[model samples]
Target: MNENLTIIWEKCLTFMRDNLNAAEDNTDLKKLENSFDLLFDNVQPVSLNNNNLTLLVPSDFYKEYIEDNYLSLLSAALKKNIGKGVKLWYSVMENKPAGQEKPITMNMKGKSVATPKMQETLPPSFSANVINPFVVPGMKKIHIDSNLKADFSFDNYVEGECNKFASTVAKSIAKRPGATAFNPLFLYGGYGVGKTHLGHAVGLEVKHAYPEKVVLYLSSEKFIQQFVSAAKAHKQTEFANFYQMVDVLIIDDIQFLSGKKSTQDSFFHIFDYLHQNGKQIILTSDKAPVDILDIQDRIVSRFKWGLSAEIKSPDFDTRRKIIVDKLSRDGIVLTEDMLDYLASEVKTNVRELIGVINSVIAYSTIYKSDLSLELLKETISKIAANQKKVINIPYIQDVVCEYFGIEREQLLSKTRKREIALPRQLAMYFAKEFTNATFNKIGEEMGGKDHSTVMYACDTIKDVSKIDKEIKKYVKELTEKIKQ
Candidate 1:
């Protein structure tokens, strides 16, 4: 009977998918395909009792999504596979904690079964209203828009060895907020590797679990601007009070606060106030606290007080999964060979991988071209070319090593001599300046050093260049050479 359930569900899914494919949808193809995938991945057939069929779903969100978008199509498929009089029902399982949302699914032997709400208007993944980060007009309560993006939920965040530790820490903070030791969680990583995503995800989850909590998220630049405005009007106390009053505060790109004396000082006091009050603070940065430039020692110490998680670049296996999953959601299909090629070539970060995929999809859909290996290769090369002549890690290393008159072997070696060490540091610094590779990746190319080592190298070069005229001039010369 259980096997029959799986078999029947498989047939129904196929029927529904085929029908959806044939339907004339003025809606975006990606949205249509995404909706189909949402259901295929999330819903499973439980048991048939005479004239009724029950499907297992993860939450009421799934139930509402299916009934709202695909209820009729599902009804037709059920009629085709089960019986004309059969009705569809849902058994919504318990709401799992945020970031731990792997729904238990049966092996129907088809595409893993499920539910997609409408593509564009899908509700926030959390159950509660996202805390507005502003005061609502004419309302007794203050509501501020939190600016947490809906798509950055844990459901969409791909976890792997590179990001598992950080992802886990973010999840823990989400569950307990400031109750955990990871208060003022500091997340640092290169561009688009999900430091910002995890920051917003944590804020969203905290809002979801504790609706009464005043959760707010803003960029460091935004914070700075607000502070400048406050300073202009002599409202610094109001600014500090506004932030300190929040239960959970998330700030992205904290590295931007570098060298801004007034802003950093204000934030220092606000951070201290929040931490002393047991309020949770989340921050994202491009560099680790120890290597972060121009911030006060006290503020840097506070950044290190909580847990700091480093999100490295995703590896080949993780990259491959990202290509498949992201392309699938966007309604683009690639062959195994194509997927393998992409996973290997676009190895820098997730954001770059996504950009490449989007370009391919756009070209394919517009020109009606096949997603050939040649097309994929050509697309990747063009994108690579567009990345500023691909001033990449190896090229930067070659430039720095040759300019310093050091052998490539020594530059990439464990030698700590100043001649070799400074040039190696230059290579690491230039790789960061010239390429999109993450600190972890830059470290990898520069002989298995960790991200902190990469950060330290960059920091050392920047600090030395400031006071040492010779070093400063040499850095300028190398910068021009790298661009050329």
Candidate 2:
């Protein structure tokens, strides 16, 4: 038995040497072998009805990292050398070492005693500075800040008709920073859209592509905090200088800058400096520049100088892609039906979608069970069923009329002239499609028109939409904007 165990251990070492380039050092191999020997010494194989071999590790981090990164390779090696159908399990020992030698006996009354503890202990894998040799030399440290989450990137941003154009432009800017025709790009949209994700993606791309470039990515709240700190310390100039020096500036949630006149004034100077120097500036807010409250005209004009795009709430296809991408990254396999259900039900935002997926994964991990569509539905039903209050047609008409620089009376008028009539027809069409009102009711709401006029307006939109792609696109967008 001793000879067989020694031979098995040697075969395992040989496999490791052949398969892993990072573990090529002779000293590292010796240390690993010693650690394995120490671990196996304290864990005697149970003489049960199966041929299962369990290896004990010192920490949960060791078990998880090894399981995720190297378990399959190790199992394949074991099966290749020791015949076949060999099973292995890795678990962290619970009881602390007290120099005890407990006898491990099977139900058959056969017994094996644990070996003595090692004189030199191996370091726990979870220790702070224990570097994985496989990781890139300079990429060892991953710094996470409250304003900068590790998971916010283009990979997780869902794409739909509502936001496809904006997402595409953002990705292009990220791929080639400071090179796009639209310098100092500003993205505006409704709340819960992916404006922040696009802004963060720009920073992430810059860091990954041009690692040497100094990138300062922060939220407006962080900027306010730092600026306040600088003021308290009489170092406002220092803060300004630091912000001015970055190669790229990404500010998220710029809407928060509203009502803070002093902060906005300081920000305007920074914006001007960055814009004049050709440094890429990416800003995201919940409203368009012209609509932002209490913002200086100079700042608003500067914001509009570059291209302005908006990301609307994701549609069904985009939501599904978001779910699939997020789950795939976490190493979770979800069925098509499960993904469809999630995509259809969780239609709010990317963050909520990810939350649901995380919850499902956590439940599965905790229970030591397989993931099923039924389990996912049961887990998500409580959170997903909270219905959002549907907006009425009159509300949409009011917002749309206000947005297009048209009056409410003009929308209900029956004039067929292109300029006034086009916006009017659009209002009527939206009223018919988006609201719970009937044709007669919509026509009455428009301007005391008959039901036939409402039907004609709807038909006119459908016919024009089929013939003119540009008009169709604009109407579709207007519909989405009002709905969002």
Candidate 3:
């Protein structure tokens, strides 16, 4: 029976290779097979009856992983080779022969750690033993609530020049906690620039790469709140001790810690303990430590102990890519012109950019409007709060000519044609409205008209806009265009 089972297992492996190789595009299947080789390959097939088979694995973790992730693939491969309707099952091997070696175990860091064959149940509290928590009688081990969000991972983080350096440092800290010079990664940036996202990503990555390592992520506000609660309950020492046990502690919005002298003193001690123990720390703040006001000098000094990386406001190209990425995720398509329009208009922070895109998508859905340039302009005009820029006479002239479908030279020419006359007058009016250029300066720039002509043009447009809806619409559209 053992020999037959071995033969069937070899055939199953061959079947897996053939099927998986044929579907090379199925990367998830390929990853499952890779995990199989890393985990299930060493398992011994103990029984086989025609299409029914059973294999013995070393630990519950291995059994659970195989059952959850690869059982379907393994069964499919076995059926392809053995016969239709073949079934497979796994059982834990509780006993081992003398002199047999224990199965190798890989930790979250992907490093092999030697574990004894026999398993033991541990309490909830953490301990000094890095590999295994030291057993304590009567006192339970601490349970660390990491408070990290799973969705905020490094994989989904969009990397660009504005945050590449900070992302790199975050990834390094994730790989080897407290091993690099960046023992504590201090990330400072404007709100919505992805500092909180990056902080969460670092914690999640560290937890993934080192499952045994304790990770805790909390906002500075929450930290202060917790400290206050603990102090009120007279459990401050317990609070401090619990934090000291975490391998990686992520605190967001450290700027809020200002003016909280007691919280600062408590955190200073926790920071010192964790740093001295070679644990990793991550902090997010709106400003750098030196610029943080009302904070103790010693606390600020500790913040400056590690590398400080800043995430600046994304540039035009980066913002463009961000909008494209967002639209792609929502399966929405926009023309290059529309994308450029959005990227140009929303040049603030990432949060606001995403908010603007969401607003546009929502408006399109509710209004049942196709994503035309006109719809885009109207939506932007409605939603963009910070889209204003300093205006100039040249910009006004350009908008006027573009709106009337004429040339700058024609608008500025001596022609008295109604088409040219109206747009030229509108340009002079906007030049007076939007720019600091005096009437003389505006007239001198526009076909060398007299200052009185500029004044008369402004009055004519303003009066017509009051009673003429067509003129009002034109003025509104031109105003929105110029602002955008």
Q: What TM-score, computed on C-alpha atoms, does each candidate reach?
A: 0.57, 0.50, 0.52
| lDDT by residue for model 1 (356-400), tens | 888888888898988899988988788778876567776677678
Candidate 2 clashing pairs, residues 3+ apart or interchain: none
* Candidate 2 lDDT tens digits, 353-470: 6777788778878987776778877777755456354566556665666557775556656677787777777777888788888998777566667789889988898789989997
Which 10 consecutive positions of candidate 3 have the poorest summed lDDT?
Answer: 128-137
How many pairs of residues in model 3 come into backbone collision? 5
The true-versus-predicted C-alpha distance at residue 376 of model 2, in Å, is 3.3
Candidate 1 similarity to native, TM-score: 0.57
Best-to-worst order by lDDT is 1, 3, 2
Q: Can you tell me which runs of candidate 3 are displaced by over 4 Å?
A: 1-142, 367-369, 385-484
Tell me which residue pairs clash in candidate 3.
Answer: 108-209, 124-141, 125-141, 125-142, 126-142
Clashes of each: 15, 0, 5
What lDDT does each candidate get? 0.75, 0.65, 0.75
Q: Residue by residue across 1-484, what tens digits does model 3's lDDT show?
A: 4776678788887776677667778876765555456575667777766655667777544554554456676778776767787656554444343576743332221322332333223223323332111223235654666888886788767777788768867876777787654757899866688998898998888878789998888889888988887788766676676776789989899988888998887888778778877899999986667656678988777776667888876878889888888888877889999999999887657887888999988987888877998889988887645555557775677667767988666877888999899999889888888888999888866856889999999999999999999989989999898876
